[model samples]
Target: MALSTAPGPPPPGLSAAKIVAYLHGPEPYLLIPDPTPGTHQALVRWLQGRQAVAGPVVARTDAGASLRWARTLLALTPQWPGTAGELLFVEDHLAKVVLFQDPLLAGHLSAKWLGRLSDMTPRQRERMEQTLLAWLEGGGAAEAAQLLRIHPQTVRYRLRKLERIFGGSLRTPQARFEILLALKIHGMAAECARLRHRAEELPARAASEPRRDARSIGR
Candidate 1:
């Protein structure tokens, strides 16, 4: 599968007739960009039209972190809705945390859900994480702002920023669920990393400690 920066109708041969051939048999393979709602729905409709046979496993992610998570999806043995007309999408933006809702095989992948956040400063990361979690949990800006001790306008600003980063996932109910899961799992991963780092430091610190020999001790 080739990744293209272009968006819109997928390059030729992506119709129901050619999807399987392109994906599995090769020759004219699937070439799609990060899909927009228009493209996603179009693909959905194309698959819907072929609702007789089991469909192939194909998905697109609009999340900013998709490139990184793409490695995770590739590492797993993929499966798609065999019951034609079903849709599959993989993205860190939302849905069961990272696309497909079927937790990939990685044991420590919750960290990947952080996407770009992994590159952010501690304060920036905390604020973003808190804003998202509060907004989702409280179900609105006002409540979230109250919880975060900030103005609703601040919450709205943070939300808009998150919306831009996550793309269309913020607009759909299913996507919202995914966004929430991403936040939850990211926090879990961050904590795990902290613990792992601390554990590593403990061994090093222990090795460096000064020791008193039992023979040198005198009562």
Candidate 2:
């Protein structure tokens, strides 16, 4: 008996179980009956030969397997920094099968960077957030100082304090680039939650409104 193997989703007449069995079988054997002699038999032999070659080739090239290995390494060591959820998400996204296999990039973010920002006092975080927004809005140190109602030197000092807490050389363009992205993502998430809450409030507000039109008609 000759075997048939098709790539991707199973053929119309085949079930998933049969397809899996064919792919995972120890030897390169097709479930299909042997084709006729001459041209058909030659084609079947060529296809079987290709299938034998393809199985090992796919296993060698599997990106998911490589990602699993990288995840295992991360699990074994706590050297990589950041929130566990953040690290896992970043690792999974960057380790997608389509992306060429490479070492996990999440390790580049230091542990200090991933530590709890909540450790900073709420006032400190609020001040830092204001300074960041001002800076992002193209405010110079003087403008930021005016916005915060602080001296220019105080603005500079607070920025330095923020840099220390964040654990990155924000002075460099490259470092600033990464930090800005992280900050923007965090801000957007907060904004989205706020907007969703406001949207939920709107329905209740509309329901509570007095029936002005009906009252006027009755009057």
Candidate 3:
């Protein structure tokens, strides 16, 4: 069953079975059986209201693993570097979760596919990566142009450049899949860097803010 760990009384249409008492604290979990679309939406809304996140459905015996998955999802939230949300669902990001389970492997895969692009300027690299990923996802310049909101000719130009860099690698199915996964990992890494920068700035930002004196509160 899926689990939500928002601290509060359970919502309507939920039963006693939905509530799981935690061994350590006042916080409780809601167990969702058979997460239909309606139920998913309901859980999403409930969690959103509480600014919480939920883990994927697993057998009751796998509750510990489910909580581990939830913590992983949490680590990717807000300042955690990847997706930020009031209520993130594991089902929506299963592929990413699976892909990131081994970050060292993911890093190596990204380096294998994207290492050459590092020589280019950031702007040049961004454009090429976006165009290439879109092309890979859409299977053609026209479809990729639509996805990127660029002209087909522009996509064609980028693809030609990419062809020179990637050569016959893009023509094979396995290589294409690997390149696509690598590009996604690269993007996630970029997001992580940005989030880390922002997080580092937080302490300095807080220290710079003026503190109010306790005696001034009643003024």
Report the number of the highest-lDDT candidate. 3
Model 2 quality (TM-score):
0.40
TM-score, predicted candidate 3 vs. hidden true structure:
0.68
Question: lDDT of each model, Cα atoms only?
Answer: 0.54, 0.45, 0.73
User: How well does model 1 score by local distance difference test?
Assistant: 0.54
Q: Provide the TM-score for each candidate, comma-separated.
A: 0.43, 0.40, 0.68
In candidate 3, which residue ranges exceed 4 Å CA deviation? 1-52, 79-87, 210-219
lDDT of 3 by residue, 79-121 (tens): 4222233666777877766777678999999999999798899
After superposition, the stretches of candidate 2 with alpha carbons farther than 4 Å from their true spots are 1-116, 133-140, 146-150, 216-219
lDDT per residue as tens, model 1, 85-119: 33333432233235333445323343444565667
Q: What is the Å distance of residue 90 in model 2 from its true position?
A: 24
Model 2 RMSD, rounded to 1 decimal: 16.3
Against the true structure, whose TM-score is highest? 3
Can you give the lDDT of residue 70 in candidate 3?
64
* Residue 203 accuracy (lDDT) in model 1: 55
